[model samples]
Target: MQREDALRSIDVAVLAGGLGTRIRGVLGDTPKVLAPVAGRAFLAHLLDYLARHGAQRAVLCLGHLADRVTAWLAQGDSHHAIDVVCQVEPRPLGTAGALRFVRGELRTAHVLVVNGDTFLDADLRAFVASHRLSGAEASVLCVEVEDATRFGRVEIGADGRVLRFAEKSPGPGTINAGVYLFSAAFLDRVAASDAASLERDVLERLPPGMLHAVVTRARFVDIGTPESLAAAAEVIGEGTP
Candidate 1:
């Protein structure tokens, strides 16, 4: 399928429900996505990236400071005008739970998912096409970094099949890019939990071939900590990814 066609057909689901516990003390009352970066909300950058890739709609799963994110979207964005749907979580739901909450609203059999706090400038079309061609139910966008200490490593075979998830380490390794293309059936396997990690509970258990990986060299910046948030502008710069 054409890249433009793929974007229109697939819906985006962003996980922005976390409390931002690590940075909340510094950025009081602000949701992680609302964190200022390069003079604008970080989410604006993410939305722009999606818009550039031809994504037309999104489902934002929000909880902590949910109103803030929604209000930002409600004010109306003139730049990247994609249709937005906000799914407010009654309580904190883990990554997997939040995605599950929007099950019916996703509308598509598969949806592109990303972490609101992380900016992974990957090629959306290639990521989607990779999953389509691999015949896998799920695929994680992976990127190689000089140090995998920040995020645990994801071992992927030469065929792009996920082998195992390794613990954090100081040395260089491949890690999840915090982006994914997941099938509805694969997400349905998650039977509701107080808080479940999409990685630990689901993806990690899938058979080698059932889950795949798409590697990219796009810049990756996550604003999980105050330090990272401060450094984001330098990494992302003033241009769109």
Candidate 2:
């Protein structure tokens, strides 16, 4: 498929349901996605990025403070016309569970899932093409960091398939950038529980060859903590991926 067509074919899901415990002190009661960054809500930049890449639709899976996100969306804060929708998790469902909760709303064979609090400046078109070419059930975007101490490491085999994941340690290594393209079948395999973690419960259990790695040397930022959140404005400037 053509790059634009391929991008439009998949529904994008921004996983924004976490409790934001790490950054709670900095942002009181506000959902992490709604936290101010570079004078605008973080979700605004994310939706614009998707729209720039030709993503037609997006579902913001929200929890913790779903009303805050919904209220923000209601005020016409988003400038992009990317057909945004909100799915509030009845409770605190983990990443995988949150996706499962809104699986029926996603109207595509494949879904691009991203963390609302993180940004990776990589080509969405290229990632989609690579995922289709690999034929794996799922593909994860892996980026090399100078210090992978905070984020655990992702091991990829010579064949470009994920071998296994290693615990966080001090050193330069490739880590999961929290961006994923998953087939509908892959999302279906998540358990029916409300608290299953995407990393611990689903991803780590997958076989070596089942997950493909789309490695990129792009700028990656995780705004899950106060320090990282403060630095995000510089990493993800206006219109950055």
Candidate 3:
């Protein structure tokens, strides 16, 4: 699909509310999304990727040190037409809970949701198109990993529908790439509580055929740890696959 056409069909929601407790040793007092990678805030690189891939509007779910993020993004209109929504949780809300906070803002039949702390190279337009065509409640981006010990590993059927979500399983498996295309109907199922997890509560509870997975043939990195953050910087700096 042409970039312009894809841009018109989808909206973006970036989950940036995490406290980055795991990387605090390397990123003290800074939100994970603002950690420097390749001389720019990692969030900048994420926004650039989305914009290049035909994302016209973006909603950023902010929590920790959100004012700093807001001020920085507004410095020069660097985000183009992207919109930021502050979701100040009284206490930390898990993935799905943070999303539920802004459910009303994402008023689309399907919206693309991405983790702010990860860099993914999948063709987002193709992912969204596939989700729309498959008619599934949600479609997740999955990538094969040599070690799926630290992430949620997905088991998919021959038809590409997700069979199960195995969280942090050992051995070789396709892990969740932190990218997703969600149907609007699923958001209505999210309760107004602040302690829901997408992996444990939502995805796991879905029937076998309700969810789908798309395997990505591109490079991806989760930048939540110090070592991975360094690796992400190297990837961006070298511009190598």
Candidate 4:
């Protein structure tokens, strides 16, 4: 399929249910995804990004303070015209569990799973194309960083297959950008219950070469902490990706 058609055919699931423990001091009662960035709620920016890429449907997997997020969407603050659906998790499910919980709401063959607090200004079209070409069960967005201490490393082979997930260490290496593209069949294999982690339980245990890694030199940001949150506006507000 063409890039636009591919993007339109895929659904976006933003995992926004995490408790912002690290940034609680900075944004006391605010949900992490609602933290202000560039004069707009961070979730708004994420929806805008999806709209720009021709995504027509987005299923928000919310957990903590899901009502607030639903209320925000009800206010029609998002500039994009994309159809948005809110799926509130009954309890705190890890990233993998969240997807399994909302699998019925996903209406596409491929789903672009994105972390609510992280942003990667990479080429979505190319990423999708690579995933399609690789024929892997899932694809991960990887970026090279000077320091991989904050984020753990994602070891990938020369052929672009994810080899292993390494522990966080202070050194220059490639890291998972917290963005992923998974085929519906892949998600169907996950257990329907239990709070399983996306990193430890799912991706880490995937067979070697089963997962594709789409590495990019894109500008990336994870606003999980106060320091990164403070720098998000500057990086995300810069030029278009």
State every prediction's TM-score relative to the real structure: 0.94, 0.95, 0.91, 0.96
Evaluated against the true structure, the overall lDDT of model 1 is 0.84
* Candidate 3 local lDDT, 9-107, one digit each (tens): 567888888889899999888889999988889888887777777677788888888877887786743544545554566666778887887787887
Clashing residue pairs found in predicted model 2: none
RMSD of each: 1.8, 1.7, 2.2, 1.4
State model 4's lDDT.
0.88
Ranking of models by TM-score: 4, 2, 1, 3
Candidate 2 runs further than 4 Å off: 1-6, 191-195, 238-241
Residue 108 in candidate 1 has what lDDT?
82
Q: How much lDDT does candidate 3 score?
A: 0.79
What's the ranking of the predictions by lDDT, best on top? 4, 2, 1, 3
Q: How accurate locally is residue 171 in candidate 3, as Cα lDDT from 0 to 100?
A: 83
Which regions of candidate 4 fall more than 4 Å away from where they truly are?
A: 1-6, 191-195
Error of 4 at 55 (Å): 0.5
- Please, what are the lDDT tens digits per residue for candidate 1 over residues 1-241? 5555567777899999999999988799999998988888889888888888888899999999898887888877538779989999898778889887887788888888899999977668888888899998888999988877889999878898988898888988888988998887766666344437887877887777677899887778889999989989976674544
- The digit string of per-residue lDDT tens for model 4 on 40-77 reads 89888888887878899989989998888888889988
Candidate 3 positional error at 99, Å: 1.3
TM-score winner among the candidates? 4
Model 3 spans with C-alpha error above 4 angstroms:
77-81, 191-195, 238-241
